[model samples]
Target: MAIPLSWWLTVAAALFAIGLYGVLSRRNAIGVLLGIELMLNAANINLVAFWRFITPQALTGQVFAIFVIGIAAAEAAAGLAIIISAYRRRRTVVVDELDTMRW
Candidate 1:
């Protein structure tokens, strides 16, 4: 038997929620970046699942999801580079430690 669309959507929503929670609670910059990556993947899953269930005949949703994945990869790379640079300069990756440059 095939899976229901509602179930897929629900799972996607849960993934998004978990990612959001991680982003909100994590103190390490890398952890926050991981959360953002998770959030992006959750969105990608939702898009692909919706395409599979709601519009199987069309390719738009899949195409958009692919674009999102590409963009997400770029974002992750850039974010990691920045995080590395920040850690190099600050000697710590904790969010609380980032406040010194807030001025």
Candidate 2:
């Protein structure tokens, strides 16, 4: 027996909510990036679950999930690079501490 779609959706929703809370509450740059990644994975879970339950024959959802994975990888790389550069210049990775442009 397969798992229900509602179960998948509930898991994804919970993951997304946790990620959102992390993104909003974390002050560290890396923590925020991790939260963003969590959100992306939650989206992927939802996409695959919908595709499995709603259109198992079609490959669209799998393809979209793959694309999202690629995008998330790229995003993580770029975000890390930015965070590293900011830390190098400022000696800190706290989001609020890197605000050099604040006038």
Candidate 3:
């Protein structure tokens, strides 16, 4: 029995929505990053699902997915480094509280 594309799409949509909510509602920097990761994962799922259903012969979709994963990893590393530096300077990881960026 094969699964349908709609099912995969629906799941991705839900995951993306939840991630968006997390990003918008969270005050902590780490929480926002986690939301971003979830969104990225949702994107990955969509890409793979589409590739599997639309063109299983082509590897482009998987290549793109891998690229996205690489980018996400770099983003996470840089984001964490910045967050850690900010926390060391300000002692808080709350986004609204970090106002040092404002001129």
- Compare the candidates by TM-score and give the number of the best one: 2
In order of listing, the candidates' clash counts read 0, 0, 0
Candidate number with the higher lDDT (1 or 3): 3
Between candidates 2 and 3, the TM-score winner: 2
Give the clash count for model 3.
Answer: 0
Evaluate all candidate structures by whole-model CA lDDT and list the values in order. Answer: 0.91, 0.95, 0.96
lDDT, candidate 2, 9-78, per-residue tens: 9999999999999999999999999999999999999999999999999999999999999999999999
How many backbone clashes can be found in candidate 2? 0
What's the C-alpha lDDT at position 84 in model 1?
A: 93
Query: Which runs of model 3 end up more than 4 angstroms from their true locations?
Result: none
Order by TM-score, highest first: 2, 3, 1
What global local distance difference test value does model 3 have? 0.96
TM value for model 2: 0.96
Estimate the TM-score of every prediction: 0.93, 0.96, 0.95
lDDT of 3 at 81: 100
